[model samples]
Target: MAAVNRVFAAQLAGLPVFGPDGESIGKVRDLVAGLRLDQQAPRVLGLVVELATRRRVFVPMLRVTSIEPNAVTLATGSVNMRQFHRRPNEVLVLGQLADARAELGGVRVTVADAAMEPTRTRDWVLAKLAVRERSSRLGLGRRRSSLQVVPWTEVSGLSLGDLTEQPQGAGQLLMLFDTMRAVDIAATLRDLPVKRRHEVADAMDDERLADVIEEMPEDDQKDLLGYLAEERAADILEAMNPDDAADLLAELTPADQSRLLELMEPEESEPVRRLLAYSSDTAGGLMTPEPVVLSPDATVAEALARIRNPELPAALATMVFVCRPPQATPTGRYVGCVHFQRLLREPPADLVASAVDTDLPALRPGATLTEVTRYFAAYNLACGPVVDAGDHLIGAVTVDDVLDHLLPEGWRETGLHDVRSADPMKSEEWERA
Candidate 1:
């Protein structure tokens, strides 16, 4: 008799599958599991296999005669070649569970991968998970150095419901949504039920939620903010970049906008309020109020240190604005900006003013979208400072914000921004029209 076999979901994926007569089949694309309310662990239904023809088919677990490290053997050489369709009660393990977050013994952990085992009844069940833990010593440089295999009963906060239907439980989904970008998480949340979406949002900290909210579509942004408590919503808005916060608030009713603004801290709400005063299509409306600003007298080394801040957005960090006194808004007459490249090429002791690009034209707050786009294209600029009539720098427009406005409506739903190629938890949802 064949030895009892068990393997992790991650290991099982991509393993070559064969027939009882030794004919080659295809590879395992995903594993389907049936959620059980009474049992913490779900039963493994079967496999979604991809054939040589690039067609996906469902092969029941009963047909799986032997499970080995290198391959899975079936009971017979034949398999039903019908297109795989997820049943109403089934969830895709690799598509949805891998990388999901779980809470074990009051400690939050990530499900880096999962495992399955056979019972006495000859049925395979999702039995354990490989949870990752990072040492705190690394701080921002933290890496998954250890993985613990725990029974499914020790985990919580994952939605095990049918992927095509309403999700069941919620605490965290997919390793704090690890190996996935914020925009991708927002896109996935857009497809979830309102309650499920809210659950996922609630599980995240203010900063992470703010990042996800900023990437969501306008309608989804409003819906999610509306679902949150007033104080909670205000906090999230405060956490987001002023430009993104203002854009989201602009979509709400005047009264709703006023309420959230009132609840926000004065310093955080001030810039957003100013941004809201501008027309949506104007340079002022699209610019982020926060950018790295330094005195022209500062050394290149100081400027480089400021840009190294982990919280600074990539686009905004590409250049440092040189300003005079009144360091806040109306940043004393906009002297000029020094590109990061210049800082790298110059001596650390050199004053930033020496490297300032005064020739680059500053954008007027009232400049139209077309004019701004032309300005960027003409100057080959990735970001441009916004100034008032008196040449006081108020904010900056990054290339990303400009592209967000210029892209077609419902661009997030399109696969143009899909990060699946880098995401290990693969799903075919983006392939749909």
Candidate 2:
């Protein structure tokens, strides 16, 4: 009898897969599930992996020999992602998993009914795979076949999972619990080897956790989300980026979907609803609710006071947002923003508009970053502001915040490099949620 901490092969889905050198190969993308229904030596005989670089690869059982906290050791010195056949009955590819997602919020998006053209020709064609839908027993296009292709890429496989049977040993029993309970992101994030990280979105109970995972690559996010209960899925969507959240909501059935949106607080739902109303690719669609703002009565000093307040939002500062007193318009209302440094240099009695640096570029809430970037170069502003049709301020986001999209993990949590910026954060400035 081994310790319970050790996961059996059947329980290893969603565990972190590692490399021999102890570096991460990335999580196990998904397990080959259907084939085992007949014989059941193990719940899964193989794992379909989508790599960080956007490539899809396959790993059969038997080749795996040892699993550890950081790596998955394989029996063969050479591992090919595609050597194992992805039988439709035992498929674990991206296209097979996306059909499992549940929609919530008022947002709608179609998962790609496509598959990655495997590019194993290059010893390394690093890529990232995105999963968007679920799969079923029936073949494609049939009423039961909603198989959507998720994306993935490859990394080196470091070690085997659980090290259950040694390189020289065999004899194991397969146990299948719900996939949701079997995988944990925190446990996965800890990079425990032998256990591959599986998509278990439906398994999670915490909206905040789901929200954090939503910011991850789609395949991983979709996997986690698929395991969730419908309402729980909605809760996670409610806590996500509006554009992303809205997109998922649109995928749900009308009934299960609406119930989840209704579960959200009005403020969260409103932005997601607003995002849902826009054309996905248009400036109106991609723009976030974050925009710079100013209070009409706010003197340059007072405005600087807000910027200097460490507690003001990190995402908001990038745009130099100004706050209006009660009952302010949402857009086109600010006279303009003054330079933060200029406040101290100017005379004490200087009028705010006099200090107004109007030189800073401005943007409507509908403006996309692509459109706003030109202004950033033309005017040299750190970022731009967004406004509603009425010209009232909504939220202010900056380029750094925009850069969150580029980060391996987005800015939901401040990272190590954020220290200099985060140092300015003040507890007093945050609006109580």
Candidate 3:
């Protein structure tokens, strides 16, 4: 994962969006977002994209690679060109997701596998991974192992510092990440406005910042989301725990839901769509998307091999259905599946069928919401799989999906009472309470 770059909804409001080759793709126009309230962090759902033709487009956050003051970047240069060449609303949302699946989204933040360890040796040795035939000839003893050093090659992208690098007495950061760099300070404005701080924080290249901000109360999230476009807000929500994703989407309009889902892949969107389709209180409706699938006759080595493919996405990976054959209709009956994570704990050659939880509870088509709720409460089950009369896996219902439906009107609330002004800090007073 790379670091996430950020900017306030206000600053990014009119930033020009650019292609990788620095072509002017368009500019940021307005931010589409949910409502918010008192001193809250924000959530972004999407962006109102404006092409050079003066046509406005709705770009979901996932498609937004980065947000800088002068320019925005996308994961791909060719985003729905067919639609872009057409008029507004003619562009489909799914095309953006297809682009994202191809790794089109630009860097939201810059990231590195970093550690916060203190070090002693100022002088250092380096590895030349980028150079061919450079097999790390520089050798150091174990005593030098603790020397603080970062592999320069590991840096994938570098944010162009504000066209100036003058060493100042007090440093005025373009943004503040948890990371500290050895640089001369220009000037530190101790009294920068909170809104400014929020905007500056948007430039941070930290994925964890969003998480920590989101972990605050809904009121804060609403405020923060107010500073982001709806598409970006939706991107963060989609990346969140499924439970949070459902909760956030519930507060959005049907049109927004449709738009956001269109930007998400079928693998990620389909299950949440299923979860959203339920009454938040039923088992057929409350099952987690994650499931255990298996090849009915798979050998231990085969089973182990599947687990090693981390590149395989989560929803697909979680399914361990032990069908008689792999990836097709089975000749034999559907056998049991062992949870992939737990498979390693047992004897290496243990068959999946023999290792499965035989007494697993499942849901039928017509199970009542109350009955299913009781099953979860009494059994502490995350969810149960739903099967037809033939016992073939049809779908699942997770507990969070149930809450999305069962929770009172409060669950969908974005907690933003609009302030008097357009900006989040100055919303309508009626929106405040």
Candidate 4:
């Protein structure tokens, strides 16, 4: 194997770990480094190897025989199977240090990566940082951030300063798992310590955070929201689905709920406020105020284009509701709905109104959970519309939401491990050192 004498922390992630005899172990999920009191580089502690069981364990640096481009070879095949827990002085290199802010030559920069090298005594230690300069504050027409590598001691803010004041790093972490599902991200967040979790969450954009929060359990969602600044929390809520946002808000104290709602824009908070007015078990509370609603004049091509949005949930994209006018939720005259398959069969130039399916009954705002469940089952529907007494299309209830309510509490957390541990090569993968 080609040896890796000097490697960036981010580069080590996902590389498979192997024993001295070339038996496969686990993969490198992260590197643990023990911070020092002075300017010296932090001592490299170990590799956080995640096994096929989805359990992570620490493999000490001393046990690593060689670091190759494709794998980390260990000194022995025997390993400590105990779960890895971060010590007080140790920090996850890629997880907590990447994307950190610092000063390089009197200019502010963000850490893109960190490099580690072994000393004469044969101990690995962080030695250099790859940093990208922040954009010009003078509105200089979108200059790209420039990257540079410097000795770790030259940059300020490299040390984990006051945890409360320090900006958390998550760029590399997000990049490594960019393709992960929101549910998978939520599961990963659950594994982090509270402080670390908040740091990671704080680094995510409002829309991304909203998606991940929607998949988390109610208690986890509440706790994470509480940890964020009230303004940021409100912004994230605005980005979430109206029903999920309302559900999360309903769990908070009335005063907290009122304050957050007040922070949100009037237009954004209106649907959420309306949903909160209903009992949590009712259709009004379960349905998302934002459904695929198009005007009767909308052509099949337009309807097809709307549902094709990558961000739209599969359940919500299954059908589009046709209304008279004012296509937004609480739309005019609940005319009828058209299934996606029907739109596919019709000509693109044809009016969507001609293909509407008005025979399926719409549920009322006060429909009980059981009634909603039966409605979906009876019609074999993935999505059903919720209409008001005046026959105004108000919202949509999807099968996924129904499943969330019907499943036992803590179901997300219960199935998280199993979802992550479903590898067919469980026996073939073994850890070393």
For each candidate, how many residue pairs have backbone atoms clashing (under 3 Å)? 5, 81, 67, 1
| Tens digit per residue, CA lDDT, model 3, 1-433 | 0243323333554478876667786666444332223212122334556554434444555556665546778765223321112122121111111011110023121221121111132111112111111123456652311212223233222211210121111111332322322110000111122343344435533344344443444554555555666666656656654544554565567887787778766666665775677554455444544444556555655677776786443444543556554333211344555655666766667666666665656676467877777766875555455654676665555565555556554322221221122232222212112
Candidate lDDT (C-alpha), each: 0.78, 0.44, 0.43, 0.83
Ten-residue segment with the worst summed lDDT in candidate 3?
A: 182-191
Angstrom error of the Cα, residue 296, model 3: value is: 2.3
Best by lDDT: 4
Tens digit of lDDT per residue, candidate 4, span 329-366? 88999999999999999999999989999999999999
Off by more than 4 A, model 3: 1-223, 241-243, 265-267, 299-345, 364-369, 377-383, 388-433
Q: Which has the better TM-score: candidate 1, or candidate 2?
A: 1
lDDT of 2 by residue, 185-237 (tens): 33222121122233222233465465446445444455555656666666677
Comparing 3 and 4 by lDDT, which wins?
Answer: 4
Winning model by TM-score: 4
Total backbone clashes of candidate 4, pairs 3 or more residues apart or in separate chains? 1
TM-score of each: 0.67, 0.44, 0.39, 0.72
List RMSD in Å for every model shown: 9.5, 17.8, 20.6, 5.9
lDDT of 3: 0.43
Order of all candidates by lDDT, from best down to worst? 4, 1, 2, 3
Model 2 lDDT at residue 174: 10
Q: Ten residues in a row with the worst lDDT in model 4?
A: 424-433
